[model samples]
Structure formats: structure tokens, C-alpha cells
Target: MPLLRARPALLYAAVSLACPEGALADEREEVRTVLFGSLDAGRSTFVSAGAKVAPGGIGRDGFVTLATLGYGLRPERDWWGDPRGKAGLTPPRTLRHTVQAGAVAGWQWVRDWGVAALFAGPEIAFEVLDSPGTRKLPTPRIGARVQGELWARPTETTLLTTTLIAGTARWSAWGRVSWGIRVPEWSAAYLGPEAALYADRTGYRKWSLGLHATDFAIARLSFRVSAGWVYEEQIRRPGAYGTLTAWLPL
Candidate 1:
């Protein structure tokens, strides 16, 4: 299967929308903010911050809507030499940076047995490549993204989720099966297996074990962590990868 390549912050936001009954919800309407970061084994890193606002009267009978805005940065290194060669003076690595800003309107509906949500919006980004020998100016690009999520609860303690995110530039899809576990003083804990596919030049696939926690604090907050290996068909060696995200409601 292919792995989805969505930004971790956006993925967390989609998960929050899918599981509205979890720690992301409050009795009253308010704005929720989130800060997230992820580092991959390939030396790629991303950081993002976003906020969602839910107005009163938008949610009724298991249906809700929210307005969201976010900004993200991706910084990665590109080396000029082959790693398989003997140790010698290696060429300097280039630093490539991508900055993005976007907004989306999301709608979610929940029933006794399942939940569904979708969000779509436009984004603009700038990319800058700083090579060892040359400096490049920021190049601008415009794109749009559409993301959908579904959650099904077969039993009181088991939940299944599938998410797909597609955009003008890239696409990714993932699925997870979680079993709710008992944790002292915590509102919820889920242990699960997750798999993902990304439509990229290298066709990356990810398999990992994941844990999701909600309401662990007195205030509204959630945490997710995943560790696993990533394989690319074109690459000879697979890489180990891990991601941790903390979301706080303010």
C-alpha cells in the first residue's frame, strides 16, 4: 500500500475533528489552538501552528462546523555527495525551506455508530533553496487541499479511523485501529496500529505503532506518539522514524 504524506499538524487537526467526543470538545464555543512539530529520519523537519474557532449554534444533533487557519515551515537538508562512498571531504549540504499559510472550513457529523468530517481550502507557499555555492530567492506557489476522515466504533472500547488528504501538490492516506484502554486519572487512552501511504517521487510507505491520549490534563489537551520504519522502493535502506505531537486548547 502507499503512504500518505500529510503534515503532522494537519493530521492531528483532522483527528481532532473526527473524534469530537474526545478532549478537543468543550461544552461552550471557543477557539482552540495547536502547535506541532515533526522530525523524520531523513533529516527533514516541519513545524506548524494553527487555530480553530467554533461558534455557538453551529453544532446541533451531532453536527458541527469550524473555521481554521494555519502556518507551516519545512526545512530539509540536501547533500551533494553519495553516502555509500568512502569517508572523505564531503560536499556541503543545501538547506531548502518551504513556508506555507492556509485556511479551511471543516464540517463534521457524528452518529451513534460513526463520525465523518471533511475540510477543504486554499494555500500559498514560498520555497527557498540555499546551496553551498549559490543563494536562491523565494519562489511562490499556490495550491489547495481537501481532507476527509471517518471514524467507526464497533464496540464500546474499539474505534477505527481512516483519513485521506489530497492536494494540488501531494496526497496521502492512512488507517488506524485502536482499542480504548483504562488509564488512571485519564479520560481516554488508545493503543493502535497504523499504516500509511504517500504519493511521492519515492513512494514512501510507513508502518508503526501509535498511542493516542486525551484529557490527560485538567485543561483540554491531547497527545499522540508513533514510532515505526519507513520504506521507499527506490531506496536500498529503510529508515526508522518517530513522531510526537502535543495539542493544547487555549
Candidate 2:
């Protein structure tokens, strides 16, 4: 997917205009850990765990870092085979394994009303095909990503967020806007619409509507459930997927 390539000057200008004075005073360092999983028909099962740390503390005004590792199990038919028929017929329903590692470094600014973050990083991925008579070598790819996020609270009970992500390996651009309603006891519900454009070996465009609910009943822990339907064009395949995630502060 193509990475979001908006000029950095514009992003900085937007942040300066939207944030108020109070946002800069209280910065502290923190850590967040997340575990998430998703499954889609005819696709694959995906699972990952990651952590983000602000070593200088939240209000310190420095760089934050993130690291994550993930694995995927895909159906055998999804594997690529030799086109000359020299590899013989394709194997039965087998499974392919993919492993990925990613890292990010970004600066964040916090204001009383909201926060803005900008980051750019590189990712490395490897895939292992498991088919009969196929070599077991891992295929590797390297890519870069640029992302930005903004959160604004226009009222005590309402919050708005926007996110943009772009990547070179897959050549895709994605953007999302969401509104959340904060209830008592730190619980919230949010609804968002997202759009993505991908240009790769097989190109496609996708639009999705998603809903998320979160509960912070336990100290330092949060649980979330989200679901969405994706309408895809180009290849003409539509799909739905749901995810469950847990957030822990460590």
C-alpha cells in the first residue's frame, strides 16, 4: 500500500493551529501493551502483540517508540506456484505461515483539548509456504510506512479522531475518522468510517464502516470489541471481520 505522503510542514502547521497552550505543560512517560487477533473467511487468521513506550514520560516532549511481532496462517491455495506446469499440480488445502516485525519512532504533543502524533518507520516481513514438493525457504520483503494521528475533544462527553497511514511495500493509503461518546466510569463507544486505496500486484480499493466499544472496568486494563464490513473493488471481493483486543498499562 502507498504510504501517506502529505508534507510534514502542513502537518506541523495544523498541530500548531489546533492546540491550545495548556497541552504542553503536563508531559509524562508511559507504556502501553496490546494483544489483538482477527479472522476473515478465505483470508487468514492474524495475531499480534506489541508495546509502545514513551521513555521520557508523557509530558517530556521527546520521541516515543513502538515494536510489534505478528504471525499469520493462510490457506494453501493462496501460495504462488511455478507457471510452466513444471511444479506439477497444486497441493491440497495446506497452510502458509508469515512472520512480520515492525518498529516506529515519533514525536507527540499533548494539549488540554487533544493530541497530535507523527511517525515514520520501516517494516520487514517473511513468508513461508507449506505446500507439497515446494521449497521451505522464506521469502522476505522490506517496506516503509508514514502515519499521523490527531485527537480532539470538542466537549466533555465527545471526542473526535483522525488517522492516516501509508506504506511502500504494499503501496496503499488509508484514512479514518471516528467520533466517540464517553460515558461515566471511563467507558466509551465509537463509530468510524474508513477508506483505503491499494496498488500492488493485484490492486483494489476498500471502504468500511466500523463500530467499537470499550470498557475499563479493571484498573490498568481495558477490553475492546470491534467489527466491520469491507466493500472491495477491482477484485470484487467483499468481506467482514471482527476483532477483540486487550490493552494493558505496564
Candidate 3:
């Protein structure tokens, strides 16, 4: 998916939101923070840090919020302006910097259902090329997401999320249906999948498919993986990426 190309962060969010759960209720308040960094084989590097503070488990009357910032050291810019095949041509230099901020707030119900609002804005700055004809450009996106859970259980959760974007420029509107499954308590594993569609002024903008997984490797350390595929017109880019995070509970 075009999104899979430049927006790996959202894919991480999908898995992060789906994987964690509560085993026993704790009366004391708790704060958990995670910091992680990754370098793709393509020579792009990223770093992000965030926290989740939940008074009542993350599923009940509390919120889960995170903010992430990253840049691509040698980014291929073909996926920027046009998702369709029309923009197949890539920029001369593969370097770009990106800044992103996002937040999500919600009221958890009975440890299963939830209502939340999500807002995110990302700005991109392309490195200038030597050739005047290859001058750089800027791209920014402002968007919001409204999500609600329809059914939830100790072992599974289902959510319907809708996203809208509007800014100094035009963007895409999309909706997603996501489902998660928890492994047997003794195993401590999680898996989730999501399907989404985007629409624009032209027509069906893009269709995306995503997957998430988490496994505990040792004490206070966990592994996370996510990947997605986006289809727009005759172009398709399926990207696979993820992160491994270690947690410190304070």
C-alpha cells in the first residue's frame, strides 16, 4: 500500500492498541513507558518514545495515548504525492525528514467497548537536490480518527474505526474494521488483522490490509511486528516493518 511505504507508524499503532491486556486488577495507579529505535536495511532510521497511563486497566474508563517522531535518512519519495502509478518516477535524492504528532482519547466501557477520538498531523521536508529542476517540495497531512468497539472479550476485541483528513491540501478518507485474538493465558501471544478503504475526489482512493503480532521474549521485554499492503489503481506496494520494545513500569 502507498501508506505502507511512508506511514509505518500507523501500522505500529494498530498492533500496539491490539496486543496489550490485563490479567489481574490493580488498585494502585500505574505508568508504563517504552522507548525504541529502528534502522531499516534500506538505510532509513527512526526513533520514538511514548507512554500509556491507565488508572483503570486500559480497557476501563481510561485512555491510551502515544506520540512518535522519526525521519528517513535515505527515503525514496515516489510514494509522496501520487499513490497511483502516474507518480512512479522517484525524486533524485533519497533523503527526507518527517515530523509527526498524534493523540487518542477514549472512555473504556466494561473492559471491552470504547469510544475514542484520534488526531494526527505530519509534516515532511524533502532534501534539496543539486539540480534546480530537482528542487524539493513539502507535504503535510492533518487527520482525525473516530473509533468504537462493537464486541470485546478477554480473548478477543473488535473495533470499527473511521478516519478523515483535511488540511492546506486534499487527502483521503478511510474506514477500517479490526479484529484481535489473544492466545491462551499460558502462552501470552497476540495477533490482529485489519482491512481498510480510502476515498477521495476522484473515486476509490486506496484499499489497505494490515497485520499485527506480539510475543514476550523475556522479563519486561517484548517483540512486536506489523505489515500492510495498499492498493491504488494499478500500483501496489506491500511494506513489512515492525519494532521491538522493552518496557519499564514506574
Candidate 4:
């Protein structure tokens, strides 16, 4: 799943959005994420960790635009792409492998009730489509990506978050929106429903609906989780999917 990979910042958004102005909900000001799920073709996993820092120091007003520098590992295997031609003139469902590494930097406009941000970066993807019996195909090696986010709290105990990402690599894109209510007894956690959509140049598209949770902290680490069902346009059926995200201070 090629996303804005904004989860790097999205994790930060989780903390910043819910915090009081000029204050941080958690003292840990870093992003360490592990997003993993099941794909019918195979399995999917993405892990990234980076810290947020304001140059020099933060202002008394608390308005800040933080930069992120870190590492990301995105591996796609047994993943299928659509045919390259029309009229049945191209190969179909070509399985491929892709490797990507990139950096993301964004500015955050933080408020007591919400946060808005935009991020952009370059991604290099090394791809090869090699199936046991199919012809080897050539693919591009690099791409650029951009993403935007809006996280808001409509009520003292509710959350509404949305993020969108697109990239030139594999012509992939992703978007999701989730709504949750705060649970004071559970470390002020938020729980609710979420919907996500994604697509690729291979003409693969999917829609997913599931449950999401936020702010489950244990000691120095915090956690986020999403689980649900996905309907694939390519396969014309439904499959199970789950994702877990963790964050630690740099």
C-alpha cells in the first residue's frame, strides 16, 4: 500500500492535535511507526521512525513547524499490477517486488482543538516484475510523493482525522478518514470507525472499512491500531486487513 507515508507525521498529529495549546500531550516528540496488514497476494509491512524538532527552540506562542528526518522501509512482494496495454494486449496481473526509501518534511499548524499539515518528499523505488513463467518487465526506479492532513476535535472527547497521499512511483495513492470518541478511563484514548481507499498505476483499487483506536500508551511507548474488511476491485471480493502503529521518542 503506497501511502503518503504521512503516518510518520500522522503519528505526530495524533499527539499534537489532542494536546492543549503550547503543550504536548506526551513528552515523547518522535515518530516510530509499524504499519502491517494482510494482502491476498501476500503480506504487507512498513516501518518508520523519526523525531520532530523545531530549530533553535519553540516559541512562547507555541506555533511551530517541525521537520522530520529518518528511515522508512516499504517492501512490496507478490503484489500484482494491471496490464500495461488495452484490448487485452498486455500482460495481466503481473506480480512484482518494489523497494522504497524516502524522507518527509512538513509544517504543522497546531491548535488546541486540531492540527493541519502538509508534507512532501522524494521516494526512490526499485521495482522488478519477475514471475516464474512470465516475461520480465521494466519499471521506473524513483518517484516523488506529497500528502496533506487535517485532524480535528469536534467535541472535548471526539476525534476526526483525515489524510491523503499520492506518488509518481507505481502511480499510487491513498486516503483515509476516521472518527473516534475519547475514553477518559483508557488513557484518554479514542475509538471509532474508519474508511480507507487506495489505488495504483496497475489499476488496483480497494475500499476498506474498519475500527480504529488511538493513544494506548504503556510506559514510554504509545500505540494505534486499525482492523477491518477490504473489498478489492481487482479481485471482486472481500478480505481481512489489520494495521498497527507505534511511536517512540527520538
Candidate 5:
């Protein structure tokens, strides 16, 4: 389970943290693929895959304007039954299967240790409810969504990232911020604290605080991993959460 697994699907409209290390530093045309998954208190899970297309090897004066064509597939589930199973009580859990699809023209500006980006697009979502708790099904829908991101290295060893999404589609309506202090010997990696807030029409609202390590590199992949405490207004009690996000360039 992820201490920060509460990465709701709405955030995947998503992938707001663009580490400079994976943004095609080579100058040739490239696609930056992202794979991420998150889980909380041994219950909910979110998995998403998306990509950004941009030119490699950019900027000489530490500043450049770029556009990336981006799209993603997000599939997720939230189990609303049984709390840590006790005794012989095995109850069928209420679950939600949600799939989201969307595309965006991503605009970005990278300058020195700071990056700002914007993306907007049309999104559609299909949801299936296996909730033995509530025997109701909602209609499918679509909407235009916009997302904004800001990442900065305020000092040589500390980093800040903030993301906001608004509009339609199950979530594009959340915001998250993370702060990182660079590790002693790893230049591209940081360990820090993260906070997030999410809300929706379905009455699903929650908040979390966790510890995270961002932009850890293993060969061709850059990874972000988190784990922490979460409190959901809809859930009976606070739960454990965590998430893993990886980026690959090609």
C-alpha cells in the first residue's frame, strides 16, 4: 500500500510533475511516457499511463517555449466495504470501476530551475458501480478540462511542485503540492513532505499528508514514491496510503 496511494484518477488528467531530467534533454523529437499507480489503506487503487511528445535538447539561455501533444488512459477502483476484515466476517466490498480518456495540447516554459506548464482538453469517463451498498448507476459524461503545473528549485537543495486541475471528468478538480529537500549525494532526487485535497459531486472528498521521494533515477526511468496518512470524509476512518510514479523517455 502507498503512503500516498490516494492519487485519485482525476489527477491523472494528470502527470503534472515534469522533472527536467526526463523532458527529452537530448534535442531530438521524443515521447516521455509516464506510468503511475497509487493505493490507500489496502483499499482503493489508481493506475494511469500517459505520454508527452516534445523535442529533445532544448534551451541554451535556460528558457524555452514548447508544446507537447499529450493523452492518457486511466483506470481506477475504490473498494467501499469491509474494514481490514476481522474474525470470519468476509463481506463483499462495494467497488467502483472508472475509466477516463482525454487529450491535451500541453504548453510549457522551462527556465533555469523553474518550470510552468498548462494543458487543456476534452475528457470522457465511463463508470461501473459494484456497490452492494448502493444499487445505483450514473450516466456517462464528458467535459473540457484544464490543468496547470508549477515546479521550482527555490534553492540548490530544495524543490517545490504544485498542480491544479479544474473543469469536468470525474476529477480534473483537485490540487496537490509537494516540497522536497535534495538528498545528500543524489543530485536528481529529493525527499520531502506532500499534501493534497480532492472533492467531487459524488460527495467524495478527502485530504492527505505524506512523505515522498521524487525523481529517483534507475537507468532510463525516473521515479517518485510516497507513503502517508489519509483522512476521507466518506470513509469511516483515516487510512494508510502510498503511490509510485515513473517516467520513461523514448
Candidate 6:
């Protein structure tokens, strides 16, 4: 059980360390909006929506802007009781509800590189072990990202780009890289691999690898699909899943 619990914490920690420094970039002000949803093999579902509008890049030559907002909902429950069969063991674990809201902003030096700062408020709602009422516990989040483009090749209007990011969130640092395959059929793909360290005070680590696909159907609309795997080092519990994200550009 200790091994199973340690994995997620480590992955979350690594995610915190993979973003770039946005306060000091070179670019004009820009705004980006994103929304994502996911479900696991265990039937757990999660949803999130966020928007960011930056007014100016950090410095005079910065090419990116800074702005932020975020919200999320997720519920988790343990249907199977503890398998340990140890003394003083409790009954089944009830469902846990989580609501989160936050703000973040970042600047970019180019299309593929920049930095950002994230602030979040996460609330954990749960009922007393034996009681029926609910209680909400709020937690704070602070994140920093240092990201840059590692490779890019452009021929006329055709281009292929890859970017690397290291971000710090709470007490963990995460590393991720995104690959964009352009030209050919106007399609893009992203694969992100992340490792989390020192997550939730557990000495364990988690590894998560994800893939995303984007198809450009029109000038203003796109279709996206994604899949990923989450593995815990200590336990045999590994999560595998896929998802879809639709984007309409304004």
C-alpha cells in the first residue's frame, strides 16, 4: 500500500518542475486557452478548464505575455476494502471529492520556449470516516517552469518542433518534452514523459508517459486525441488510458 500511494505523488512533483521562466521572455503579449478531461481504467474521472491572457512579455524584447485562471473537479473512491486484513482495520473507504481553482501566467521568448508561474487553491472534500457530513480542506500550490525549444527544422512553411520543460510545483520537480510533427498532413503529435520526486513526503517515484494527436481540419477548428500510461514503481498498479480534446481557435 505504501508503494501504491507513493507513485502519484512523485509524478505530481515532477510536473511541478517542467515549466519555463515566463517573467523574462521575449515576445508580444498573447493569450492561450486550454481544457482537458480524463478517465482511468478504474472508472475515475477528472475534468479541468483554464484560460490565460498575458498583457506583455516580461522584458521589452519578450515575445510572450502573462495571464491566468483554472478550475478542476475529480472524484475518487475505494470500492474494495483493505486487503491487508490487519488488526484494527477499517471498513471500505468512501468517495473523495476534490475541487480546485487557481491562476497562473507566463512569458515566451519564441514560439517554443518561455517560463511561467502558477498559483492554485485545491480543496479536498470528504465525509468523516463514520459520519455522513462532508468537510473541505484547502491546500495551496505554487509552481514554476523553465522551458526551451531543443530542436526545430523549418523548410518554407513546413516545420517540425520539439520543446523541453522542467517545472517545480509544491515539493516536486517534473521534466517533460513535447514533439510537434507538422507538414505532411497538417497533423501534430505530442509525447510527454514525466518523473516525480519527493512527492507528498513519500520517498517513492512515479513515471507517466503520454501521447497526443492533433488534426487540423479547418483554419479555426481542430480535433485532438491523447493516450497515456502511469506506472508506480512499488506496486503492480499501472494506469493506461486515452482521451479526446476538441479545440476551436478564435
lDDT for 244 in candidate 1 is 53
Q: How many backbone clashes does candidate 6 have?
A: 33
Per-residue lDDT of 173-245 in model 5, one digit per residue for the tens? 7789998876756645678999988776667767889998876667866667888987766565788887777
lDDT of predicted model 3 = 0.39
Tell me, what's the RMSD of every candidate? 7.8, 8.5, 9.2, 7.7, 8.8, 11.3
Q: For candidate 2, lDDT tens digit of each residue in 1-250?
A: 0011111111221211111111122212232222222232224455776665656654334676666677866453433454434467643555657676678779877565656788889987776667654666855888997777776666655556676767665455667666656554433333333333323332435566666543332454445455676655532566775555554444
Q: Alpha-carbon error at 46 in model 1, in Å?
A: 2.0
- Clash totals, every prediction: 8, 16, 2, 0, 13, 33
| Residue pairs in clash, model 1 | 2-197, 3-196, 3-197, 3-198, 4-172, 4-173, 4-197, 4-198
Worst 10 residues of 5 by lDDT: 1-10
> Residues 182-215, candidate 1, lDDT per residue (tens digit)?
3434444445555655543224344444444422
lDDT of each: 0.45, 0.51, 0.39, 0.55, 0.57, 0.32
As for lDDT, the candidate ahead, 2 or 5, is: 5
Q: Could you give the candidate ranking by TM-score, starting with the highest?
A: 5, 4, 2, 1, 3, 6
Taking the tens digit of each residue's C-alpha lDDT, what string does model 3 give over 1-250?
3211211112223213332333223411232333343332223334545454444444244454444444433234343343443556643433434443344444433322333433344322223322334445644655543333333332222233333433222233445555555445624445677665555433424566777554433454445555566554423344443334433333
TM-score of each: 0.64, 0.66, 0.50, 0.69, 0.72, 0.48
**Candidate 6: regions farther than 4 A off:** 1-43, 56-94, 111-175, 186-206, 215-219, 232-236
Better of 3 and 4 by lDDT: 4
Q: Which digits, one per residue and each the tens of the lDDT, describe model 4 over residues 125-191?
A: 6656555444665664577878777887676667788988777865888888999887667666788
Write the residue-wise lDDT of candidate 6 on 98-209 in tens digits: 3333333333333232222332322222222221333444345445544333222232222233333333442333334444333333333223332222122223344556
| Superior by lDDT: candidate 2 or candidate 6 | 2
Best by TM-score: 5
